[model samples]
Target: MSGNRYGHSSPPMFLVDSGGGHPGEHQYYHQQVLGQGNPPLVPCWTFPPARAKMKKRGTMNNGMTWVLIMILLLVFAALGLGAYQILRLQNQVERLTQEMPAEVESITAQKQVGLPAELIKMKQIRADFIGAHLIGHADQRSSSGTLNWETQLGTAFINGIQYHNGGFQINETGYYFVYSRVEFLIYTCSHKDSHTHRVSVLRRGENRTIMEDHQEGFCKSSNNQKWMTGSHLSSLQRFQESDWLFVNVSHPLFLSKNFQNNFFGLFKI
Candidate 1:
């Protein structure tokens, strides 16, 4: 036996001669060494426990599960928010639909109330204008140097003026356009035959002719035949309140019997 450098005695060593050694001889020698009751030395190693590895794997699986659960929760929350917005929009549409008819009716009522008032205002403006139109009648006669007129005959009317005793009574003082038409008939045409038509105004018992027409010496028919003629007079004149206007003719018997042949009218300008 030899000693090691650490001053410890080494184990016993065996040397085999290889000149004619049999394969079984080596095994025999090792069996003889182990049979001495000395077991061979082996190294021991320490590793982590199986339960610790299993626990780590289980922790990883739990973390994955929690992540999946969080994703599912977030998806459900988004769906709920979308549903709330849709419901709010639908409610707004319903409210507007309910109010539409009343709004339309209110607008229509405003138009209905406004139109008639405008029409009535226009009618009042038309009525405020002063004018009159008078026609002749067969019963009308010129006896007081002024011809009488039919106030209620065919197409005869008076406004802002009055007819009193064969004259028009002015109610408003202003400028007026006065006009008259007279037709004449003659049974015999002869020399010195004449006719005159005049439009006169009377204010404060003074009579003045504003317009006149005279026709004479035109009766060339000598065979005593009937003749027809006409005279018309018009003028712009100024008057005061309570003034009277009248029409006069030189020959009353020659006046036409046809009522349509004579007319008189005036209007404020």
Candidate 2:
């Protein structure tokens, strides 16, 4: 009957020890006393410690720096590769320009044997035959049927329907120039099935293009279907050196490798 028991409502929560308990710090708890005499305690709950406060700005900056470096390296590599390719292409163009001749005089000058009158005759006949074939009136048809032979030569002419079987004969003489015409001809190295510009001298015709296709190194189309006649060797006295320029021709259109099977018809105009 001497003391009255009073209950305490509010409790104290420390800033330093805001969490439930200090590690190894006695879990002592204090609350407010209301009326005085024997005070009754209220349950106390500890607050949580402040979470780690610093922002990871430095970490983010480092990550960004690394990314930028990688990007720059990639960019530089691409630029360098592009520059190298351009230089290579330019060098290639210059080399080709220096090594090859595009003009008629430059090309013809290469031949030690000058062009004589007989070359004109050969070109004329070849042109005529080609023209006929294009018009569907073929004098000789290629294996692909692009060309056809109309007549076989008689015994007097060594060069019969097949140029390889014989040579040719010439009875006229004069200053001559050699020129070639190509139709649907492909270089062996190129393995092409299309027409290309190419020529070669049978007896050192200098102005001839070695090979229309570059890959085949030094293979030349047969000049057998060709002709050569001139006063190049025979002086003015040999008004008409009896010479025969016979050619052996084959149809490369569909690859008539057994050239003998393809008989090309040729004659003098």
Per-prediction TM-score to the true structure, in the order listed? 0.52, 0.28
How do the residues 56-166 of candidate 2 rate in per-residue lDDT, one tens digit apiece?
566678899999999999999999999999999999999987876322233232342323222333445555321011011123334422332222321111221122212
Please report the candidate that would top lDDT against the real structure.
1
Query: What is the Å distance of residue 41 in model 2 from its true position?
Result: 18
Model 1 lDDT on a 0 to 1 scale: 0.73
Q: Compose the digit string of candidate 1's lDDT tens values, residues 203-228.
A: 89999988899999868866768889
Q: Cα lDDT for residue 133, model 2?
A: 10
**Model 1 deviation from the true structure expressed as Cα RMSD, one decimal place:** 27.6
Instruction: Give each model's clash number.
Output: 0, 20
